[model samples]
Target: MAEKEAVEATVTGNDQQVGFRAMVMKQAIAYNLAGSARNDANEIVHFTLQGDKHRIDSALATLQEGTKRSSDIKIATTSAAIDPGLNAFTIVDWTSSSRNITNTYNLVFELRADDTAISPTDAKAAWHQILEKTLNADDLKKLQPND
Candidate 1:
């Protein structure tokens, strides 16, 4: 079998509040890739693609093409460690209820887990549990960077 590869992609500009993440998920699924997509506090869309290099490249092509609502799209991709645990592509929810940097870090750590079998959803839930034990909602709000 061909070596499985992965890429960490950060997409900015006209990528948020649209269906870009969902569209990317669809493309990734069509390509049979495994990874995730989510929007960040700064209106940036971050995603990861893991699987065959050719398929990843194909998905990247479609992503670069942009959705109808997307303009000025800029995507930066770096080679990433393959996550063998990701069984399917998913769109993670990034709500503004408690937008702390820790949430992003947790998601990043989960996505980059090279030796674990935990899914992103499971990992995020576990991270939330840690936060629940250590901090209240008000404390989490304090951790959010000042606008």
Candidate 2:
């Protein structure tokens, strides 16, 4: 049998809003690889895969392509020592971590004689409304600005 290998990768760019982690987990399971994936505060998706060398290479190719919702995805990989105890792949939720990031929405309103520029309060409200439609409650909570 071929020697097993481990790899750690960071995937960046348009990876957040999409179901990137779930997709990656599915692929990892399909390859019978063991490890975990999570989103970091910097909006990067970090993951580790360990298994047969050939399977790891194939998984890397799938990850680099990314899910349909992902765009401009770039993946960086490095060799890692395999963890003998790893048995299953999972999505690591870092919502409780201090590193959790709040998403800031900015809207620039142009002043016009016919239309008044939007007030800061109104702009903030509008931004939250957009988030409500696009993000889940948990994700919305993480986006709350620090006082």
Candidate 3:
């Protein structure tokens, strides 16, 4: 199915604060939200994201910590025509006097899982690569089994 192009995700909590912007940016980038965010005088964090539906959904889900404070987050959607030329989702600089971005959208292809791990060595290396790449994902941690 074809995915939507634009998403207006309004994250909650610390919206009136400056440091929270960094936290939101990190989480959004990890999930590949191509847009920008900044704190406004109305205490609302305005975010303009242009990306695939799955990536945008994933970013929104991450922002919802299930806490009371996080529940305040809200989002509104509409059909938008975007230039599908972006290489990847990114956080654009919002410091410019004009808060505008060269909007572009691209379908992010998922890597196939190495289910061909028929051997222990192969399985180890495949899993190792997955873990190593996840280093930048703060939301991801060392895998643990049910003790």
Candidate 4:
């Protein structure tokens, strides 16, 4: 049997709010890949896939060819170490969790609109708080300036 391979990809450009994740999930499932796909706050679609080398390559190729709703899709891919425990492909709903930054931001806005104790300044503070909690070490590195 051929050794399985893994890949991590970030797809940007007209790839959000247009069922891009669903499309990618469908392709991954069809290719018998195991992994997950989700959209980040910046509208980038991040995905990880593990499967036969040929099938992974084919899926990536299909993804680069944007869906009907997507335009000018750009994808960046990198080889990833395969996770032996991954069982099936899935689409993660990051925003549904209260811990998610997007959800926190939405809550802040809702509180402000409801004429609650949350003032405009409080909303801004909430935004910063959520941003800090949400950004991981990798995200912080990306935001750092070159010395």
True-vs-predicted CA distance for residue 89, candidate 3, Å: 6.5
Model 1 TM-score is 0.62
Alpha carbon lDDT at 44, candidate 2: 81
Find the 10 residues in a row with the least total lDDT in model 4. 104-113
Better of 1 and 3 by TM-score: 1
**Clashing pairs in model 2?**
none
lDDT tens digits, residue span 1-147, model 3: 537577655655534323334334544445444555654566566666665577666656655543233344445444455645543333323221112212222212122233111332443343335334533333223233210
Model 4 sits at a Cα RMSD from the real structure of 15.9
Clashes of each: 0, 0, 0, 0
What Cα-based lDDT does every candidate model obtain? 0.64, 0.63, 0.43, 0.62
TM-score of 3: 0.45
Please tell me which predicted candidate would have the highest lDDT against the true structure.
Answer: 1
2 versus 3: better TM-score goes to: 2
Alpha-carbon TM-score of each model against the true structure = 0.62, 0.62, 0.45, 0.62
Candidate 1 local lDDT, 11-45, one digit each (tens): 97787655577566656545666788887767678
Question: What digit string (tens of lDDT, one per residue) describes model 4 on residues 1-147?
Answer: 767899999997888756576566656545566788877777689998887788778778878988787898998999999988776665665342212234322111111222222233443345344435655654434322210
Clashes in predicted model 1: 0
CA-only RMSD, every prediction: 9.0, 17.2, 11.5, 15.9
Top-down lDDT ranking: 1, 2, 4, 3
